[model samples]
Target: MCYYLKLKYFTLHGPLPGMPPQFLLGNLAQSGLLFDKASLPEAHIAFKQRYGDIYQFWISSTRLIVVNNLNDIQHIFTHRNIYDQGDIYVQKFSIVIPHGLISSKGAKYKRHAGLTLPLFRRGKIVSNFDLIVDCVDKLLIRWRTKSPQHVHLDIVQQSQNLLLAIFGLIGFDYDMETLDNDNDTNKNELTKALQYFLSNFNIMLFSPKILSTIYFKLSSQYRQSQKTIEQYFDRMIKQELDNGKELIAQRKRTSLIASLVGSLQQDEEMETNKSEEDRKGLSRNELLDEMRLFLLAGFETTSTALAWFIHLMSKHPQVQQNIKTELSNNNSQGLLSLDRLDSLVYLDCVIKEVFRFCPPINGTVRTLTVDDRLPETGAQLFRGDQILIPFHSLARDTRYWSIDPELFYPERFLGADKDHHPYALIPFGGGHRQCIGQDLARFELKVIAARLMQYVTFGDGGNQVNSGGHLSKLTIIPKHVGVTIDFDK
Candidate 1:
C-alpha cells in the first residue's frame, strides 16, 4: 500500500508505463542493469518489448524516460535547447573531467567545442593517413611474429594497443609505444592510470551518488590515477604552450594539442580587449580535462568497435573475403593509402553495418529543460527528465529497415536500405552535441580495418570461444573474440 501510494505520488504528472519500482532501489533491482541476467543492450531491448517504445525507467530516485522511437529521438536531437546535456551522463563524467566538453555546460561547453571541434575535421583526419597506416602496420608486424599454427589472437588487447598508439601520436604527437614492447615507466604509467580511471569511472556510474562520492574520496587507486593523468597532461600542455606561438604562426600543424595550445596563445595575445566571459580558449585545467577526455574517447570507442569487427569477421569469412577482394581490385600492391581505402566502397558499407549492427554506444541521454509531450506516444515529459535514445533499438527496429534488421548483412546498405532514414542509423548520435571526434574515429576504424584485411585473414576459433556476446562497459565490446589469424604472403 505504501509502495502504491509513493508511486502514485510520483506519477501525478502523466506517468509512462514501466515496471514497478521498489522503494529506494527504483527499477534497477529488477532491470538487471548491474546484474548478469542480461547485458545493458539486452535489458534495454527487453524493456522496449515489455513496455513499448516509450516508458519510464528509474535509476534509484532519478527518472529517465527511455524513448526508442526514431521520430521522437529525431525531435529531441533536433531541438538542442529543449533537450540539453543528460544529468546522469554529465554528473558521472563531471567527477573526472568537469571542464571537458562531455561534462561542461553552456559557456564552458561552447568554449571547449569551439576550440576543439575544428581539429577533428575530416580534412585534418584524412591528412593523418600515413600516421594511421604506420600504426596499423606496427600491429600487423606484431601479429606476424606469431606462428600461423598458434595464431589464436586476443584482438581486444591488440585493438586497444593499436588505437592507443594512433591516438597518442595524432592527438598529442606523443609516442605511447603501446604497440611496441617498450617498458618506459612514464608511458606504461599513463596507460595504467587511464585504465584504472575508466574502470573505476564505470563503477561510479552504477553506484549511487553518495556512495560514488565516498568511493572517489577514499579510493587510493582513484587518487593515484587522477594524479598520474594530471601530471602527464600538464606536461603535454606545457610542451605545447612552450611552442604555442610558433605553432599558431605557422598554422601548419593539426594535432589536437597544438590546436588547443594555439587557441590559448591567441587568447593571451588578445586578452587586453576581451573579458573572461568572452574568452575563446580553454583554461589550463580545462585543457587537461579535455586532453583526458580525448585520450579516453579516442582509443576506447574505436578499440571496442574494432574488437566487435574482429569478432564479426571471424564469424563471417565471406564478408572478410569480400573486403579483401575489394581491396585487391583497388590496390594491387596491397598498400592501404587514403585513396585506396576510400575506393573500397563495399568495405565502407561493412563499416557502416558494423556500427548499425552493434554500436559502441548503445544510447545517448538528453535531459529535458521544459515540460513537453512526446510527438508520437504523447507521453508528458517534465523538466529535468532525462530521455535515453537507444541507438541499438533504432538499428534493430523492424519499422526502420526494408531488409530484415535482425540479419547482419552489409549489402543492406548497398541495396533497398541504401536510402534508409537518416535518423535510423545514428551510431555517432545526432544533433549539435554529437561526437566531436566522429570523423577521426571512422577514419581510424577504416584505415586499421583495411590494413588488417590486406595482410591477414581472421578465422572463427569455433563456437566454444568465438560465440558472440557483448560486455557492457564504457563501450559495448565483444565478450568472446578468440580468433585464428592467417597471414597472407
Candidate 2:
C-alpha cells in the first residue's frame, strides 16, 4: 500500500541514516536488544559506532533517534519546553501513575513539583542523616554475622532491602523493616505490592499500551497488588493528615509524606480562610500517586547503584583500601556527621566513577515539541519524534575524555578527566527534568558506602561468580555480584 511505502522511504529521509527496519519487527531484530548478545548500554555504544551520533532506530512501530553527540544532548536537555519528556516514557509511567510527577507535564507537573521539590531540598534530606546511618548499621550487623567463607552472593538483594528500609523510614515515617526480614518470603502486604509493581513494571513498559491495558484488566494478581498498594498508601496519608498539623507546628524533621500532609493541611486551612479558588496543593489521589512514584524511584535506582559499587569494590581491593585510607585520614570513625562524610573527597570520586563506568539507568528519552535541527550534527528532527540520550555512550565517548574512556579507574575523576564535559557523565541525567531525588540518592550512597568501609571490606569471590556484566531491569543491575564480606578488626 502507499502508506507502507511512505513509512519506508519518507521516514528515513532528512540526512539521517538507519538500518532498514523489517516489516513489523523494525530494527528490534538487528539492534540486538531482543536477543541477549549485548545489554542496551553496550548496544547503544555499538550502534553509535556504526551509524554515527545521530541515527534513526525503530522499536517495533515507534521511531527513536539515538543522539550520542554531547552538543546536541546539551541543547536538548537545556531547552525543556522544546524537548519534553518522551511520549514513550510518559505513556509507560502514566499507565499506573498518571497524576504522579514522573508521568505529568506542563502545569500539572509544575504544580506537583512546586509542593514536593522543597521536601527533597539538600537541607531537608541532609537532616535525615541519623535515620540513613541507622539503616546502614542494621545491614552492618546482619553482614557481621556471616562467616568469612560465606561469599555474599546476595549484594543486590541486600542493597534493595537497605534502600527500601531507608526510603520507607525517611519518606513516609513507616518502617518497611526489610532489613529484619530473613528473605522475601517474610515480606508484608505493602512490601509484596511494591515488589509486584517493580517486578512487572518492565513488562508493561515493553508491551503495547492497549495490550498492557488488557493485561492489567484481566490479571487478578495485578489488580490485587494495585489495590493493596493503594489502600496502604491511603491509610498512611490519612494518618499523616490527622496527626501532621501538630508535627508541622512543632517544626519536626521533615519526612516526605509529613511534608505533603502539612502542605495539604495548609491547603485545607486556605479553603476555610480564603476564597475557594485561592487554595493550592495536591489532591488525595495525587498524593497517593506521588507516594508510589517516590517509593519506586527512591529504592530502585540507588539500590542498583549500591550493588554495582560493591561488585566494583570486590574486584578492586586497592580502591577499597584507598577508601579506608581516606576515612582514616579524616578520622571518620563511629557514626559519621554530615561534615565528616563530606570530607571524603576520594570516596566521592569512586562513586562518580561507578556511575560513569556503568550508569544505573541506560538512558533517558525526550520528545520534540516542534521540528528542530541538531546544532552539531545538522540532523533534522520532526515534531513528535523521540530522541534517546544514552548516558553510557556519553560517559564512554573518547572525544570528551582526556584519558582513556574505557578504563574503570576512579582516579579519572581526580586526574585527566577531572574537568570532563558536563553532559559526559550524567548518571542522574541533566537539566530541569533530571532526577529530582539526586541529592538524596548521593547522600544515601555516601553514608552507606562510608559506613561499609568503616566496618567491613569486600573481597573478590573469584571470576566464576564475580565476573562483571549487567542485567537491564528498571535499572541496569550487576548480573553476577558475588563478593566476600570480611569484618574489620
**Poorest lDDT segment (10 consecutive residues) of candidate 1:** 5-14
Number of clashing pairs per prediction, in order: 0, 0
TM-score, per-candidate, Cα-based: 0.92, 0.92
Worst 10 residues of 2 by lDDT: 263-272
Estimate, for each residue in 218-244, the C-alpha lDDT of model 1 and write its tens digit: 999888988988887778778766775
TM-score, predicted candidate 1 vs. hidden true structure: 0.92
- In angstroms, the error of model 2 at 378 is 0.4
> Which lDDT value does model 2 have at 71?
88
Q: In model 1, how large is the Cα lDDT of residue 344?
A: 82
* Overall lDDT per candidate, in order of appearance: 0.80, 0.82
